[model samples]
Target: MSEKPINDLSPVVIALALLIIGAEAVFQLANAGLVGGPRGVGWRMEGIGMFGYSPAVLERVLVQHDFSPDILWRFVTYPFINVEIVQAAFCAALTLALGKFTSEYFGGLKVLAIYFMTAIVGAVIYGLLVEGNAPLLGGFTPVYGLIGAYTYVLWLRLGQAGENQLRAFQLIGFLLALQLLFGLIFGGGQSWIAELSGFAAGLALAIPLAPGGWALLLHRLRERS
Candidate 1:
């Protein structure tokens, strides 16, 4: 029997799953009075938030409420706890698109591994650079990583001996311009830092993971056989 092909669930999907489920569980425990908030919000609460980039607040929460590192992990994880409906919806749409494409192009396991690795890099970068007391949350970091991978695939597809090369370069130019526009409008912050990390990670991973567009090369080889 032929081996079952990998599913198109991206690394972001897995991270989001963990974030959503963890949030639900925490909220449920809070509702049942089994667990209290890190900031002593008590049960029956709705505006609970995780410490995003505020390591100091996180440390205080852990010390004051006796919370563990697991709680910290939940707050920092992707698909961050955002009460804003619009923000959540926007992230969800981009997550689905980037995650699906990346997973389909690169194997699911590889995508997951790369995503986590990049997340670590992103978090570290943000922590070192960003100085603030507010919470940070969002999956834009990993989403940026997916964009990096997509760009690599595009470059490989276009950087060839055909019309595709011209098309790919055009697409790349457009994407770069878009990134610049968003950066200008949004201004520099933790989000931008995460995006930068994602881009760096994507480019790093692409060097080995993609390398002249293995996907296309494989297809050609199969056709020959």
Candidate 2:
């Protein structure tokens, strides 16, 4: 097989990486007083208030019937912002690494769909299940969605190769293990709900988003029936 060129990065992958890193860069600069002003220190916090999905705000919107366009936009915008550079770097790394393969396999549109849809679903789950005013921020949730898409592709490839498909889950297993360890050391937060939900959403979406995935799902269902 011919070697793929390094410069042949998918546009969707590049776009995702840029969106995440660029947002973080702006936040970092503002925080450092390189841009904006003393008021810049609060810029990211302000963005979180405006763009991050707050379960409290969601509650007010859904439970109390208080409607606002800001709440609606949060579903799509939350994934672009992060708390700090470390958080953003981790997300950007995952997005570029997994998103390249996912976009190549599922196409740019489906990859974009999975990312945004997973974010929206994740936020919805957080709104319904999680309690507190801690707003959901960061790109990790959507990155986990990409991980889910990658896992699905690996699972399919493994099954076709007559290998144990269970091995495909090792990535998530390792990540979860690390998360548990981190939580134990640093004290856990509720954001895992959104991240896990994003993963589940991505996995379920892969059933329809993957090429021939819908037909394969129907075939399996018919066989079972």
Candidate 3:
């Protein structure tokens, strides 16, 4: 098999990974008391309030029919901040790996589109579905979108090779199974709503993002109809 050049890794992927890791590092420094101000320890709560997505805030905006810039931007910003180091590290690792694969196969622009669109859609779903004051934070939702994109790529490859197309779904199945086990062991959170939404968004977007994807999708739809 031919090996791809190391330089083939998308700059967009590297940049996104750096941004997530960098933000997490700042948050960690703040949480460790090594950094002063909002980014330091003892202040992460405030930071979360400011950056994390709050359904209450979104609800207020909807109820009042007023959208403030700060609240409006939360949809895009929430994915950059995480609650813990381990969470951030896990998300960053996924962003780098899945982002690279998606970017290589679909191009950097599509990868970025899928990521941000998934994040927005996930946030919207969470806002509408989840109640209460628990705010949604972390990068996993968008990372799940990347996972969806990767799965789509795998699905395409499997189809072309006459392999079991369902096998491409194994990654998501495993993740969801782990999530189920974790939830059973230690109560479930609403964040899964957003994460799963992200994955669905990524998978749907793949139909349009893949090469000749739109045409293929339309043809299939026409045939089905």
Candidate 4:
């Protein structure tokens, strides 16, 4: 991605990045005993427990066919819980970087729309596909949604330029490869399903969310027909 000034980021994207960073900042402060007192150190874990998306909780709700506002809320809130500062920083950077690019194409409001929508879709897919106690926490899934938007833009631009549209997938492919490598070495769970699901949802969303996206898609469909 090109170097766009942070100021160029949309207000909504900025707020989203701030929320992710601010959450971690509070946790770090608590860890250092600068805020929330001695018991504050547990704030991170507590927040994760309350906000993290747990398949177990989801399974319970599914079996009982019960719906709770708190359980549903985790779909949106899980992204805010970060286990480590470095992980949060990486998520924030990608959010800002990709959010700026996607906002240029879809506007600030739609950028946020894509973010939350993908987060929800990702969580639902995670719950359906992965069975375990480990919860899904962190904004990377939603951030991957932004990358999907970015890929859509590139795909459109490449087609307009008479280039191979397949090239637009390189970014996602590389990122997934890197993620798989890390997972192999560290031995992780099935969170990649969430990330990939988010990406797919983001792409699907662009059909309606992107400016003129519906009409353009229709035009392409007609061309194929």
Candidate 3 ranges with C-alpha deviation above 4 Å:
1-7, 37-39, 218-225
Off by over 4 Å in 2: 1-7, 218-225
Winner of 3 and 4 under lDDT: 4
Which tens-of-lDDT digit does each residue in 125-177 have in candidate 4?
A: 99888867778999999999988888888887787676888999999999999
Writing each residue's lDDT as its tens digit, candidate 1 over 37-148 gives 5533342133333334444544555467746774546434644554344555666666666667777767676666666667656765665567774445566666667677
lDDT of 2 by residue, 41-115 (tens): 898888888888778867877788877787788888998878888988988888888888898889888999999
TM-score top scorer: 4
Question: Model-by-model lDDT, in order?
Answer: 0.59, 0.86, 0.85, 0.88
Ranking by TM-score: 4, 2, 3, 1
> Which residue pairs does candidate 4 place in steric collision?
none
Highest-lDDT candidate: 4
Which prediction has more favorable lDDT, 2 or 3? 2
lDDT tens readout by residue for model 3, 1-225: 788775567888888878788988876777677778654665657767777887876786789876888788888888888888898888888888898888988999889899899998899899899978788898889989988989988977776676777999999999999999999999988899999999999999998889988897665446545
Error of 4 at 201 (Å): 0.4
Give model 1's TM-score versus the native structure: 0.60
Q: Candidate 3: what lDDT?
A: 0.85
